[model samples]
Target: MLRGLTTVSHFSDDVPAAVAWYAELLGIEPYFQREVQGKLAYVEFRLGDYQHELGILDRRFAPPGAGTPGGTMTYWAVDDVEATYQRLLDLGGTAQQSPTEHGPGFVTASVIDPFGNQLGVMFNQHYLDVFTGRPA
Candidate 1:
């Protein structure tokens, strides 16, 4: 059985710094964290509809030779593509793709966070309408 996305996780060498950076970007603190013996192990932020989660894991868990801006990419919804794109860049996230409108109101952009993971942002009309009962 396959379930849809419940969480999206990113890796970072520094948990606290990654937490701070993501908190600033998302404008909210993580709602849950995994810690063992009082040491940070993981942090998760719930955002968007379905409480879709974005998690930050300590990079120690990554396989050897892993690097930032990895192969996988996941796009989160954003209301304003241009402003959000600029904001991520301003926050030290390197640009991977500038915002581009695909077709019929679907737009997207991507960036590599300071920690080297790809972060995607999209203004997806269909997804927004289905979730919110209003067109994007």
Candidate 2:
């Protein structure tokens, strides 16, 4: 019933700023966007070797009863967890968790973006193995 990771999304109150911030972080502009009367409402970016989708939707578009921006987090793969974590902070994200190794080579970190969404990052051997077709 499950295929694979398809998309990871976040909410933003300011579309242009969020788009600019992620464009800098990912080094690519969003490939898809929806606008209402010339105002961006939603945007998507394809990233990584897997071409995983990252969506940023306006917070107003969220379902009813969704109060704040904390929920299931999807950790993105990065070459350097520590450096990426710091870079997120340097780009105005606040720290949620410092990078830490979790035995047997798994390392993860978390940060709250300027838009109040939680963004996670990791340096994973399994991801590299799967991406490169190498044994983990």
Instruction: Give the alpha-carbon lDDT of every model.
Output: 0.88, 0.88
lDDT of 2 by residue, 29-135 (tens): 99999998788999999999879999988888877644255667789999999999999999999999999999776899999889888899999999887878844
- TM-score winner: 2
Worst lDDT run of 10 residues, candidate 1, spans: 62-71
True-vs-predicted CA distance for residue 117, candidate 1, Å: 0.5
8, model 2: CA deviation in Å?
1.2
Candidate 1 displacement at residue 52 in angstroms: 0.7
Model 2 global lDDT (CA atoms, 0 to 1) = 0.88
